[model samples]
Target: MKAVLFDMDGVLVDSEEYWVALEEEEVLPEAVGEGVVDDEEITGMNYREIHGYLDDHYGEHLDIGREQFETYYEDAADDLYSERVELIEGFEKLADDLRDRGVRTAVVSSSPLDWIGIVVDRFEIGEHFDALVSGDEIEGPSKPEPEVYEIAAAEVGVDPADCVAVEDSENGVEAANRAGMTSVGYRTEINQGMDLSKADHVAEGPEELRGLLLELTS
Candidate 1:
């Protein structure tokens, strides 16, 4: 593989739990106040799926409808992304090493464009990535669907089969598999319960991820 595709939230940054906590602490309480759905159900899905879950469980509590979930999340995400989001350890150095080796990289996220912007800017990864593809920017569905990875591979000018994808959730592994790409599953404390067996490789941390990437593309 000449290029690599990454899932932005849990893979590139340690911000997935921050987002889930927002839902549990603020959004879900405002939407259900009791029990709508646990973090496991909505954690790996995109905003659209999360909104649908809310609508099915406790739609009345939501001030806005499905059409407005994206906007609401975008607004809420800025605070979380800017305030708490941090790049995975050793990510900058790994990215530099990959670039030095002539391996291109890009981001494929289930996040909205605004949230992705916040992450990209906060981490200052603008120069490291050759492209960014947000689920919100595509017409198709998010992770667990192949569209996001397809777009990401295209953006990096590489065939899906020839690109290595790094992901941190079950949905992300499914998406990469469906896209006909090899994937490395990232295991972090925040995503410890997630199933990652679908990935071609499983990594416990950034160092392991870098080693796997190098082994794959070398």
Candidate 2:
């Protein structure tokens, strides 16, 4: 692989757990007014896109306007990414190894640039990446669509076929694969239940992810 694209939430940080928790506690019950939401249907979707999805799927049950629903997520994200979640174990070393090998790297996420910025700054991992592509910057649909991954490949000047994308959600894996990149499924304790069967490979933890990435990029 000439380049590696990483999904930020569950792949780079432990933020997904927090997101799921918050959604269960507030967004689902208070905003969308749903008692049960299948996260697989939403994870890897941009926060804005998520609003459209929820409003469409649960429109009849919605208790808030689009702006208010977004506020619910934005406020929670500020606390989650900045003050709560930690970078995944071994990511600094993994990123450095990829860069040292002349493999270009980028973070491809459904998050906005500002949210990504907080995690980058908090972990000081921004320098390890050549590009940071967020869904907000793309005009196309979010994950489960190939646009974001395609954009990431372009941003790093690599063809999609030559990039290995590591993602923690089903939507992310599908997006990478559809973009013509090799998709590697990453798993954490909180997202171990996710079905990443569509990926080219599955890495169970940070160490496995590091090893798989090194092997692929080698």
Candidate 3:
């Protein structure tokens, strides 16, 4: 592979649990009342798009505006990144190894730019990436649509066919496949129940992910 593209939330940082908790326990309940939204419904979507999805499905019952609903996530992100988030084991070393081998590396995510910045800064891993692309940067729909990964491949100066994408969500795997890259589905305790069978490969944990990357780029 000429490049390696990574998804941020569950693949790079152990933040999926925090997001799931925020969505299930706080955001959904306050916006559309309890028992309406599920964690799976918004797992791989941009925070703003989560509000849009909820509005589309349950707008009639929603008493709050989208902007207001987003703050819950934004505030939670601040706390998560600063105090709670942890990097996936071996990710830093894997990123460094990829860069040493002259393979382009990047972070491609459904998250907003500022949120991506928080994670990168908190973990001090930004220098490992040749590019960082956020779903919010594109005008089109995010993951499960392939636009973000397509843009990411272009920005990193690699053909989609020559890149390998590591993802932890079904939507993320779908997006990478649609972009024509080799997709590696990552399974973690946080996403154990999600289907990732569409990916070209599957890695059960961080060490497995490292082994996959090493083999792919070797």
Tens-place lDDT per residue, model 3, 1-218, is 99999999998888998888877787778888989766776778888787778778988878788779888887788888878989899887888888888999999999988888988898888899989999778898888889999999999999999999999998899899999999999999999888889999999998989998999999
lDDT of 1: 0.82
Estimate the TM-score of every prediction: 0.88, 0.96, 0.94
For model 1, state the Cα shift of residue 12 in Å: 1.1
What tens-digit string does per-residue lDDT give for candidate 2 at 106-134?
A: 99999999999999998888899999999
lDDT of model number 3? 0.88
Give each prediction's root-mean-square deviation over alpha carbons.
Answer: 2.4, 1.2, 1.5
Model 3, poorest ten-residue lDDT window? 36-45
Point out the higher-scoring one by TM-score: 1 or 2.
2
lDDT of 1 by residue, 71-164 (tens): 6576777787888777888888888888988998998898877777888887788999999888777786687889889888888888899999
Lowest summed lDDT window (length 10), candidate 1: 62-71
lDDT of each: 0.82, 0.88, 0.88
* Candidate 3 RMSD to the correct structure: 1.5
Candidate 3 wrongly placed segments (more than 4 Å): none
Candidate no. 1 TM-score: 0.88
Residue pairs in steric clash, candidate 1? none
